[model samples]
Each structure stands twice: as structure tokens, then as C-alpha cells.
Target: MDIEDTPVLDNHMHLDPIEGQNIDAVEDFESVGGTHLLVLNKPSWHLFDPASDEATFEEVFELTIEAAADASEVLPGRAWPVLGVHPGLISQLVDEGYTAAQARDIMQAGLDVAAEYVADGPALAIKSGRPHYDVSEDVWEASNAVMRHAFDLASEVGCAVQLHTEGSEDLTEITEWAQDEGLPPEQVVKHYSGGRLAGPIKSVIAEKDELEIAAELDEPFLMETDFIDDPDRPGAVLGPKTVPRRVRWMLEEGWEDAVRRAHVETPARVYGIDTEATLGR
Candidate 1:
């Protein structure tokens, strides 16, 4: 079956154009006949780190949010937001030699920035009176307090939390962080699920871990293709093709019911969207 026709909500995508390559060309997402889109935050850490050749985090975040806002406004019911702040941010904290003092500095900087953008920031401007971005300096902490704060923020905002897990290498660490944050497995979604590790080895291990987590949380986990399809964007891992491949894989594996239960049912319930059927009314 063509899974895209079924009206799947792409839990992850980067619609903002940084290099002047307006991802909107793909944002229409013709292949899937996509119902609603969930655009992810720019890869802030990757772009910010001096070690990488990517654009600066400030530039990426600004442009990405602008594009996402525009898309959400134009599309109205079709575009949803899934702001991202992944493990890579922790890595950047470590690389920057984050200490207790640095944590204070970082938090202050974030607060200042949020206040500046409070009018436009998603969470901050929500009617529910919650903050937009989930942030932390705790992952660098030997105790995982920082990560917990981030997850707590996700739960508070009532939006699907997004992340990029390379492979089993950080699986245990992520799980620990999740547990500490009191965010059950079903509440999280892993992006770039395919390109992180070698062969079926990594996928199997990660899937098993995810399954265990989902079972424990009594909720279904979301999987996303975090990367773009454009060949020119060489850094992206999974492109458009991987999306349908995933839906098919889920169906072939007898997880179709789960996808319906988790992706469609649960998301609508938690997010307050009407999912009596798919979004294509």
C-alpha cells in the first residue's frame, strides 16, 4: 500500500532555508500527499560549532523559525511545529567547557533571547503560558539534570519532542536521561533513525531499546527521517524516500495498528487535534 496516501503527519522536517535553497521546493512534499507537516528546528549545534562547516546557529534558527512561521500561517491547519534541541547541543556545551558558572551564563543567555523573541516564540506565546524551547546545562552535569529539564519542557508544551540519536552508543545515555526527566518512551521521537550506525546492527539495537521504552511508558514511539532529500544537501541522512519506506516497514512488520494507535490516535489525543480520522477532512 502507498503509506503516504494514508495521510501521515511527517513528525520531522526542516522547512527553513539557510543556504538560500528554500526547502519549500520539497516542503509541498508531493510524494506523500502529506496531510500536516511538523517542521523541526534547525540543527543549531552542528551549525554553531566551529568544528563544523555548517552555518551559525543564530542564522539557522532565525531563518528556520521565520520560514516555519510563514508556512504555518499560509498552510494554517496543515503545518505544525516540532522545535528541536538535540544531544548535539550537549556536545557543544561540553566542547565549550561548560561548568556550573557556564550553565548560569548559558541559561541567562537563553532567557534573554527568549524574552527578546517571546512574542514569536512558540511555547512562550502559547495560550497555556509555557516556555517555547526546552533547554539545559545538565547533560554536561554528571547527573543528567539538564536533559531532564528539556524533556519536562516538552511535556509542558504538549508537542512531540524531537531528537537525533546516532546509534546504540548514546541509546543508554538517552534512556537514562529520559527516565530521569520522567518522560516515558512514547513521549519522544528519534529522527535520522537510519543513517547513524552500521547495518542492521544499530537499527535493531535502537529499535529494541525503543520498544522496551515504549512498553515501559505504555505509549508508541515516533520515528522520523530528520534529513532532507536534496542531493545538494549532502549532510542530510534520510531524504523523502525513507519516509514511505518507514511506513511500509511499519506495516509489513505488523506495526500498522501501532502506527495508527501511536502516530495518529495518541498524537491527536495529546496534542488536542481531531483525529477521528486523518487530517484530510
Candidate 2:
């Protein structure tokens, strides 16, 4: 299929209406042939005080859902929300005077709120993971507990999860956790993946080299820009156009079939959403 005919889906992206580009970024993505976006909620601290309660989390999720809804006006049924407490927020909570255990409890409560959003409709997945940075053993353990709670909530809601955590060559432990929680490992996407990780489905960054490596794997994978949508950072993780540009590049480089799998088949199967329908194929 021609690049224009192909459906380009960004598996993980964030849009901020307040301090960021908002729908303008979505317009940018659409201009470059982006067909769909999984718009995950930004961290709690980005929208409210670190010490905010569950009510604040509900507001954050509502903003995310609204952002996705607004994006659908641009792309029409191709923008979906993914809501959850950011794992790094545990650090923020601890810094705000809550103990590690208390932080875990708060994070878990936030996930509960996010899960309700998924169960009710607006969101297609939950986002959760441990801190990517180093922390005390207590905090580390607490983060893992919060992540596990996310898995449980995802299972109950029958939705996928997008994880943000330290990069690793092996994700066997994470896969096992999902399976134990009764959520299929394939439903757990490792966002910002480097490529070819051993477990949960990898949402490889849209870099050409990473996409090449992930395409070589036998397992299905998805692509993302992890676009932060910050006007100040201006393409921090990558630009809104990154995925579509990389997909076109891949097509030029003789990766048509891989592009179909990564952008269309994998996302449809993993999220249990109808990519073909959304693309009006």
C-alpha cells in the first residue's frame, strides 16, 4: 500500500491543552499522515499539586478524556485516551511528605480512578509503571506494588495498559505479573521501548534504527513518538510527525508489510480496537 493509503497509529502520546500545543499538535500529526493516536494522560503533578487527592486524579483523567474527544474532531474516532497515575508521581508524593507506603496507596487509588474511566468508556488503556530513576528500596518496592495494582485494575476493566519504566533487555518479570493478574501480557505495552524486549509487547520508539530492530522480531510490535507535546521542549521525546515520517521512510526502505503489522494489526489486536474501521478501510 502507498504511504498515504496506510494507517499510521502512534501507540503512546501526550497532549496538554494548558501548557502545550493541544489540538494544534494533533493537526500537525494529521498533516503528516498520522491516522490515530493513543493520547495518554500527563503526570498528576503536571495538572495539579503533588499532594492533590483522588478528586484531582479524576479531574486529570477528565481532561485527558476531553483531549481525546477534541482530537477525534480532527481525526474522528482515531484518538483514544489512556489514563493512569504516572509512576514518577510516587517520588513527587514522597517528596510531598507522604511515606513510601502512603504514596503507593495514593497511586493505587489514582489507578482505580483511571480504571473507572476505562470501564465507563473514554479510555482504551491504563498507563502505569515503576520509576525510571533510582530510589530507596522501600520506594522501589512501593512502585512495583503500584504497578501490580494497575495490572489488577486493567484486568477488571478488560483493557490494555501502557507502561513507563526503566528500560530493560528483559521484561519476563513484567510479563509474568500480567499473566498472574489475568491480563494477557500482550495487553501490556512497554512504551518508549528500545526494541526486541523479551516480554510485554514493545511500543518501539519511531527512530529508524529502533523500528528496524523491532521489525526483525517474530512478535508483533507497535511504534510511538512518545511525543510530549510541550511547546517549550518542542519535540522532547520526538515530534508529532515522527511516526508518520518514519513509516513513510520504512515504506521507502522496503518495509511495507512491517508497517502494516506495526501500525495496523498490532494496535488492533493489542488494544482490541478496530483500526480498519477507524481508518475507514
Candidate 3:
């Protein structure tokens, strides 16, 4: 059997459009044995200026929707959409002289648009989180406020929320915030999560941390490459094929149940997907 036919899901990855890449991003990810992908929609930081106003937010809204659709087009039901304003971009807006109020308004509008897409179709989760340990209190608060908006929208739409935050943060506080927003802890997922932090509702475990995390936690967590879809940074955080490669390693290690949980079962449970139908295993 093809190693990829073993079934694996990449829970966190960026698969947006790029001008210079030679291969199709979706095809590349799938060619490596990826069965399902959760596509995050955000402009590459190095490629575009961060937005600060309503007009800019309108453009961002369209960009996010289009990127999600782009991935879905690649593999039909295989690519799940995760839409939200970039929290780092939120912080950047505030730092670039956009008033806190303006930033909040823009982010709120972006979340509104994202929520609409989720409510409509082809979208499954909301991704809104920022690095918490390295920002000023004011910037932190602004970022947190925007994140609250994301959680609120997730609650309203009944979709999972995928977090992108520092690994060492207090997940307890994050879970509490999710609770306050009326979102169950299980609906809150920490992306790039592992090591030294209490688990959230779910987490997207990095490839290197997979073994350590699988040993430490019993909860069903997802895996990711956090692929930026950048030609200049292929395999930057990790290549698109890393998740499948990790799955192969898991199989070699006799982690059959772990593979099923992270790749098939947990994703279905968290994102409301039909993994059995997708993988036919």
C-alpha cells in the first residue's frame, strides 16, 4: 500500500495563492499522502501590507473567502476552511498608528465576514490567536479583545476555533475565555501546541513534538506542518509533506490508534468532518 494511503490529516496549514510557486500547493500537500487539510486564510506577512481601515478590511474579507475557495477547488471536500483576521496583523495595525478602536472595528468586520462564510458553506473553523508572551500589555489587550471576537463568532456559528499562539502561554486562561464566550473547551484548538502547557479542547501538534505529546496527553490531537505556501520558504516551519511523513513514522512505530485518532477520528470530532468517508478506511 502507498504510505499515504494510510490516512492522515493536516489540521493546520496555509494554502493561499502565490505568484511564483512551480507546483500547485494543494496537489503538493496531497501528493505527500495528506488526505485532508484545514486551510488557513491570511495574506503572507512579507507579501502584503497589513490593513487598518474599513476599505482595507473589505479587501481582506474577500481575500480570505477566495483563498478558502481556492483550496476547496483543489480537492473538493478535502480542504476545510479556517477563516479569521490575523491576530498578529491586528497587533500590527495598532502599532502602525491605527487606533485601538479602529483596529477593533476592522477585526470585528473581518470576523463578521468570516463567520458569514462559515455559516454558508466550505468553512469549518475560525483561526484567531497571537503571540502573547512577547507583546506590551496594551497590544496584548487589543489582541485579546480581537480574539474574543473570534471566539464569539465561533460560538455563534457553532464552529471550532483554531488558535495560533505562543506554546508557553497559559492555556487555562484561554480555556476560561472560551468558556466565557459560551464555547466549550473542546471547541477551542491551540495550533502549533505542545510542551509545558495544559491542553486546550484540542491542539495541532507539530511533527517533532508528536511523540512527546502523544506520550503525555490522552486527548485526540491533530497534526500540522503550518506550511506557509511560500515558494521562498518551502519547508520553512515544515514542508507540506511533513504530516504524511510523520504518519508514516507513526505507523512504523506501531501507533495505529494514535494515527486513527489524530488523522481520522479527532478531526471528524473537532471539525465536524466525515473522515471515514474521506479516507475510506
Per-candidate TM-score against the hidden true structure:
0.59, 0.97, 0.87
Model 2, which residues run further than 4 Å from truth?
Answer: none
Give the per-residue lDDT of model 3 (tens digit) for 1-281: 34545566778777645452313766676676666777777542544677655556555545555665665555424666687777777667767888766777777777777787788875688778765468776667777888888888999999988887877645888878988998887788888776335647455556556555663566677787777767667666777778887778777776777777887677777777886576532
lDDT winner, 1 or 3: 3
List where candidate 3 sits over 4 angstroms from the true fold: 1-6, 20-23, 44-47, 54-77
Give the Cα error of residue 75 in candidate 2, in Å: 1.2
lDDT of 2 by residue, 1-281 (tens): 67777888988899998889999999999998888999998887776677357899988888888999899889833899999988999889888788999999988988998898889887899999998899999999999999999998999989888999999979889979988999998899899998779888899999888888877765689999889877779987998999989998888888788888887789888999876678753
Give the whole-model CA lDDT for all candidates, comma-separated: 0.44, 0.87, 0.70
Which pairs clash (backbone N, Cα, C closer than 3 Å) in model 2?
none
lDDT of 2: 0.87
Cα RMSD to native, each candidate? 7.9, 1.2, 2.7
Please give, for residues 4-71, the per-residue lDDT of candidate 1 as tens digits.
43545555665536553344534444344444455655545434442222224345446556765665
Which lDDT value does model 2 have at 174? Answer: 92
- In terms of lDDT, the best-performing candidate is 2
RMSD of 3: 2.7
Quick one: ranking by lDDT, best first?
Answer: 2, 3, 1
Listed per model in order, the count of residue pairs whose N, CA or C atoms clash below 3 Å is: 1, 0, 0
